[model samples]
Target: MKLTIVSRNPKSTKFPVTLELAGTASTIKTSDVNKALAAKFPKYYPDRQRLTTEDKKVLDLDKTLEEQGINEQSSIYFKDLGAQIGWRTVFMIEYAGPILIHPIFYYLSKFIYGSSFTHSPMQTVTYYMVMAHFFKRELETVFVHRFSHGTMPFRNVFKNSAHYWLLSGANLAFWVYGPWFAQGRAAAVRNDVWIYGSVAVWAWAELSNLITHITLRNLRPPGTRVRAIPYGYGFDLVSCPNYFFEFLAWTVVCFLTTSWSAFLFNIVATGQMYVWAVKKHKNYKKEFKDYPRNRTSMFPFIA
Candidate 1:
C-alpha cells in the first residue's frame, strides 16, 4: 500500500512524502507506518512520530491502520515530537545519583559533626538501607522494568534527576546523619520493637515491589507494545500495586527514622505516586472493558 505523510509540526520540513508500505491496510499497524516514515526520514524515529488522520484524529500505535480508517494512498499528518531520550537512560541517571550522593553525606558526617561524631545504630543501619535500596533500583532499571514508552522528552531528564537527587539523595542523607539523628536514640533503644518491625515491613515491601515489576514485565511480549489487565500478586487488589508497595517502603523509612525530613519526603512522594496511580487506573478501565471492578487505584478497598 502507498501512503502520504504530511508534516503537521511547524519544525519539520521533510514531509509531503509518499512511501510504499509492505502490509495490506488491515495488517499494517500505526507503528508500522511510523517505521516506514522513519526509514525514509532519518531524523524522525518511531518513538518521536505521532500519526494522525486527515481530520487530525490521533491514531493508536497498537491498532491496525484499517481499524483507524486509513487506507491505500491515504494522507496522514506526522507530528515530530522533538528531542527524545531512551527510557532506560533516564532511570539509570536518576538512580545513579542517590547511590553516590547518599554515601558522600554518610562519610562527610565525620567532618560535619566534628571528630567526636559517631554513627548511631539507626544511622549505620539506614546508611546500608539507603545504599541497598538505590542499588536495587539501578539493577531493576537494567534488568526488570519494561517501559511501554520507549523514550521521553530529553528535557525531562533534569526535572526527574532533580527530584531523586535532591529529595532522596541530598535532603534525605543530611537529615539521617545530621545532629538531630541522635536526639531520640536513647528512647529508640528502649523501643527496639519499632525498629525491627519497620525493617521487616520495608523488606517485605521491597520484595513485593519487585514481584509486581516481574508480573508487569511478563504481561508484554518482547519487542511489542501489547497491554493486558494485570492480575495476581498485589495486582488483584489495586491497579497499581507497584506504587502501593513503593509508598509502603518509604513510609517504613519515615517511621524508622522519626525525622521530619523523612516524613516530608514520604508525603511528597506519596502524593506524586497517587496521581500517577490514578491516571494509570483510569487508563486501564478505559482500555479494558472488563477491567476488574473491585480494584482501586493504588490502595486496596479504599482509593
Candidate 2:
C-alpha cells in the first residue's frame, strides 16, 4: 500500500512524501508512520516533536494503521502536537474532579464510623456551600468562560484532578463530618458578628466571581478569536478579578468552617490561581497595547 503524508504548513514548498508499505503487516501502527516521518525529515520531526491530524486530533499511536482505515493513495495531513490537549477537555476534567468527588466525602461521613445521617446547621450550610461552589464551577465551564484556541498538556488533567479531588475530600470530610466538625462550628459561631460577617463575605465573593466571569465571557463572542480588555466589575482593579473573587470565596469558606483543612485548601488553591493570574496578566499586557497598566495580576494594588 502507498500513502501520502502532507505538512500543514502553507508556505512549505516541499513535496508530499509517499510511503510504500506492506498492506498485510498486522501490527502496523501510527507510531510506525511517525518514525518513518522522523527518519525521512530529521529537521522537521525532531526527537520531542509529535504529529497530529490537520484538525488537531491526536492520533492513537498504539492503534494499528489498518484499523485507523489508512488505505492506498490516502493523504494524511500532519501538524505539530506541541504538548497539549483540548482546552474544553481540560476544564471539563478539572471541574468534574471536584464535582464528582466532593459529594462522596460529604455523604460517606454520614454512613461510616457510627456517624448519624443528621447534620447540624453549620454542617448543612458548609455542605451546601461546597456543593454550590463546585456546581457553579461546572456551569461556568460550560457557559461562562471563553477558552482560546489551544490545549494544555494531556498529562495536566491527571495532576489537576488529583489536586482538586483530594482537596475537596479533605476539606469536606474534616470540616463537615469528622472530629473537627463540632469544634470548628463552635469557633465559627463564638461571636455572632464573625458568623454574620463571614457569611456575607462569602456570598459577596461568590456573586462577584460569577459577575466577573460573565463579563469576561461577553468580551469575546462565540466562534470568534478577538480579545478585548474586560471592563467593569472587579476587572477595573485586577487583571484576573475572577481569580481574585475565587480566592476570596475560598478564604471565606475557611472562616465559615474554622477548619484547618479548609484553610490549607484555600492556601494551596490561591497559590495556584495566583500563578495562573500572573501569567494571564502578562499575556494580556503583551497582546494589547491599551491594556490597563495600573491593574494588578490578582491582588489589587499589592501583587
Candidate 3:
C-alpha cells in the first residue's frame, strides 16, 4: 500500500511525501500514530491525537483508518512550518479528560423514573407505531451516541459537563424506551391524552431541539479552540436563545407524551439543563460585562 503524506505549515511550507506499507485496518490506532511519531520525530513529538488547527479544525484519530476511508493509495496532508508537526498530528488517546457524568445521570434517572416494566410506557407501548419512526430520527440525531454508537462532538463534552449530562441523559432515556426498547418485543410507550394535542406538543418540542442544534452547528461549529463546546460565542448576549428553545422543546415533549414516565423523564432532564443554562447566562453577563442588559435570563419578561 502506498500512502502519501503532505505537510504544509501555516508558514506556507508544504512537503508531500509518500510511504509504502503493507498492513490491515487492525494495525492502525492512535497508538500506532504515536509510535510512528516517536520513530518519525522522536525528539519533540507532540500529541498528534489532537490535530486541531489554529482555527480549530480537528480530525478524529480514533476513527478506524478504514472507517476514515483512507486507502493505501490515500494521501494524508499536513502543514510544515520548518518543524515536525508531531504534537499536532501524532494521535494519542489521552485519558486526561474528566470522568464523564453519564453514570450519575443514569442512576438518578432510574431512581426518579422508576424501573421500566415489560409493558411500561417506556417499553414503547403504543405510540402510533409510525410516530415512533419519526421520533426515531430525532433520537438518532440528538441522542445518537447511545443508539448508533457514533461519536459526540468533542467540544461539546469538554465545554460544559452539566450541559453534557442533561443532553446525554435525555437522549439515553428517550432511546431506552423508544425504538431501542420497543424493538423486537412490542411498543411499550403510549398516551391516552388528547391525541393530537399530546403528539403535537412533543413534536413541537423536538422541532425546537432540531432548530437549536441547527443554529449552533451553523454558527459555532464543532471545531473551535475557545471551548470544547464552542462557548464565547458572545452569542450569549441574546440570553441563551438555545436554552429557551431547548426548554420549550423538552417541556412540550412532556406535554405530548402525557405518559407520566416520559413526562417525568423530560421534566427532570430538561429542567436540570434549564438551570445550567440560566447559570451560564449569568456567567456570560459577568464575563462580557457589556452583555446586553436588556436581554432576559430566559423568557423576555424575566421569570
Best by lDDT: 1
Please write out the lDDT profile of model 2 over residues 1-303, one tens digit for every residue.
566878776776764778765554347677677777777767544323454555666656667766765555456677654456777777777767666766666667655535555445566677777778888888888878788654565667788777777776554555555644544345434456666677788889999999998998898888766789999999889999999999988888777777778888889889999999999999999989999998999999999
Q: Residue by residue across 1-303, what tens digits does model 3's lDDT show? A: 455555545453333445544566555643344345446555424342233322444434555456655666555555322232222111111111111333333334455446543334433322332244234434434433111112333343434443333343344344444333432444333445544464566566555545554545554334432312223332344455656655665455454434465455556656666687688667766777566666665554663
Model 1 Cα lDDT, one tens digit per residue, 1-303 = 898889886675676889898879899998888888888887888888888997989999888988988887678998878889999999999998889888887888767666446667777777787788889999999998888889998999999999889998888888888765653556334256876787888899999999999999999998888899999999999999999999999888887788777888889889999999999999999999999999999989999
Models ranked on TM-score: 1, 2, 3
Winner of 2 and 3 under TM-score: 2
Quote each prediction's TM-score: 0.91, 0.69, 0.37
Model 3, which residues run further than 4 Å from truth? 1-193, 226-238, 256-258
What lDDT would candidate 1 get against the real structure? 0.86
Model 3: ten consecutive residues of lowest lDDT: 89-98
Global local distance difference test of model 3: 0.44
The reply for model 1, stretches above 4 Å from the true place, is 22-24, 54-56, 72-74, 112-116, 183-190
Per-candidate clash tally:
0, 0, 25
